[model samples]
Target: MAKIAYILLCHKDPDAIISQAEQLTAAGDCMAIHFDARANAPDYVRIRSALKDNPNVTFAAKRIKCGWGEWSLVQATLNALQAAVAAFPRATHFYMLSGDCMAIKTAEYTHRFLDENDKDFIECHDFFESNWIKTGMKEDRLIYRHYFNERTQARRFYTSYELQKRFGLTRDIPEDLQVMIGSQWWCLRRRTIEMILDLLRQRRDVIQFFSTTWIPDETFFQTLVRHLIPKTEIENRTPTFLMFSDYGMPVTFYNDHYDMLLGQDYLFARKISPSAHDLKERLGVLYASEGVDFPISGEGRSLHAFLTGRGRVGRRFTQRFWEAGNTLGPERELFLIVCKKWHVAKRLVDQIALETDIPCVEYLFNEQETPLPDLGGIETTLTKRSRHRRSVVRMLFEYFGKDRLVLCLDPANLDVIEDFCGDTAKTRVLEIECEYSDDYLIGHARRVGLAGENSPSETVARLLPPIRNDLAHESELIRGAGIDGYQRIREAADRAENEAAITEFLGVDADKAQAVMRLDYLFSD
Candidate 1:
């Protein structure tokens, strides 16, 4: 029996939580739930009643009044972890989950996989440089003082932005520890969970710092684990399946997403809407397809080895994308799009190129000064560098002419992207809907700039504006033309093109189109 304790941080839908708990509960595995104190008292009672028969089930004695993007969220998780450890002392592995999350893999298979590989599955990356913050508020989260309101249940955030404007107070970042952030969900070993708790106790300053951080839940555990654990013991991968839309909200899975859900070889999938009754039924049917004891034995280990080996091979195959080779392009009047999710954007660009017979090249922004790929046809420029703003802007100035088109996939890059394409009337923009697949993990796109020899020193020197504060430089080009005006121009351009080409190739309507304009705070330096 594989001793696993699943900690569920539940807020609403007692029925759903109970249902999921029942499905996950087995002879060897136990469950510990920490319901938000703000939740209905009756619902909490009902959930407790529902789990009355389950001997292995436990609930946190001290419930936390959890709030989104607040310190309380982290506290709730920590409470659940403590409860789970106390309840299931014999457990080897601990999984942090939410009430909405459903187990995609059967208990037997999940146990087998984790037992075979003793590695910890936790995603950790340098916070400030990560794609996690679509807004340039990475500094705001790190330096600001954020408080959770009890009466209003609101998150009161005091950032350097507002302070600078009103009182001229400069930002104060924690100098002792570096903040690391990733997906809130993670699976870890028993020792790790205990070590985390111990570290939290010792590191009072870290705790105090994070208490005021925007989304401490995502950063707290990740930072501790990264700071304490060896690289070999940690795997930069979360086991849960979470689908997020382009807007960065948890995508509610419908019947159409059933196939994608089934395809994932994951232990769980999160934020499944309670309203998706049909979807829930389908998921139940799919999960039951394989019996609990669908004998894997040595097959599971072999499969794991095969997958890991294949991944290594794939990395080596794509090494050309990372290597510093030769400069390829200075394409004539080209269309450039800057995106974080390269693979997702690649498919759309390829389709557009195929349909229009126009030469398009994806200059992958990275930290390394890799020689650009051969830009004869549709080419991909990949590098491992972090500061791609300077390189990307330089590429636009050098390679693309005035009669070019540049569409930035991520609005975060628009600060620099708009600097080039804003006033250029000769440039045209085409709006496209690119559905990012969760399977394709962000590659070098999430590159963290370390103080190393591989730094883009020359590029930075030439660009003048530092990557960190580039968003601060107000773009008069964008301001004067107006966001609405730019949208009108893009819409007109899209309408003039073949309707089929616009719709089929770009995945957007030409008639009622809009430029992918982000909110003001997203670009605030």
Candidate 2:
């Protein structure tokens, strides 16, 4: 069998690590585990107990601190890699993983994927050029002088730079050549691992430079690899299917979205959790052949059972919205209902409204006061708690019935609404999926309506043509009206603010008006 070594940097959550190790071992791969020296004794004991029975597992001797932009993790990873290479001299590849990471494919499938790709499996995390330059600490004289001023320090930064400087030529990194910050969890061929080790030894100063810098573990390896082999290697956009969080917590896969991944050509997925159980459950059924049954132990047990239909209660809540009359009308108006803490949701709604013409309404589901806007058509305050529920229900009913589209702008609210409404679709209700943020939810809602798709690019493209046309038309109308038309339209827009008049002037019904208003609101501010 082709030998593969699994290296993991574990702190707590031994069960998760062991569970993942089981998956790796079942794939005919050997496992080498490293516990952060800082981990508590109990945590270390728990880890040992979990892996004691696994014959393929070996623990590392040294421990290191794992910090952001710190070289400790990279140092630990390098240590583990060296040990793995030394012990398993003939191993085909070294697979690095985190304690919280889960394998989406079985070992058989994973190995086959590596074989087929004939490439290292690393996610390419690139920032925009503007954002990239912003991260540089060269302006910090202390760091720059310590690392870049001296020949030894500069040489240590990267041999190429040192050579170029020696030749009296300035180094200009290409714009398209993005800074490669590879995923901490990646798979590398044996030769690649050896080459990296050789490079480290030859350029010890550069390694030291990284050691003193606030660089992340994944970035260290990625930057080194990119600096050494810029042309030969390629990052795998779809290497593995997994979800992982830095904080050791149960992985939650909200909804049945995992089914969406089956169609994609990814080798693995990580960070799967109970929160994501709905999607995992469906995926488990559809792709049972893909080792989806890999036993989920530890804190993930509840989530795993939930996905497998063995949990007491589902993670999602069903919500119901009762409409009073035709609030939306014949044309549908896209409405986003934001119900979050005031400070967070207010800015998000304002930005969305200012940017798009989509109509949005703000609500504080739990607050006693109904939201009232002052001047900009944006809600300014949450008042009147006594009528909160009644007002919210009334507003939702009116918005839906009037043909106004409504999207709940908060995930927690979505959970509540889902629970309250059950699976019934009363007036075209849509749930927005977000990663625990209201901003992401609102962004998704707008993207869905404007783009007819979820991607950022698609949404921008869809909105551009109409926006350009509107601008041109408005410009001509304003010029013709000689400022009077502009003032009249602005006054009309302000008066027609509430759902009815706005729709009438726009030659549309309440729903269409609401949608237009929402689009306007999103773009206006």
lDDT by residue (128-244, candidate 2, tens digit) is 322332334532311322233233345655654445457754433333234455456677778888999998787776665566544556456665566555444656443555433
**Residue 75 lDDT (model 1):** 82
The clash numbers for all candidates, in the given order, read 5, 81
lDDT per model vs. reference: 0.58, 0.50
Window of ten residues with lowest summed lDDT in model 2 = 483-492
Q: Pick the candidate with the highest lDDT.
A: 1
TM-score of each: 0.56, 0.46
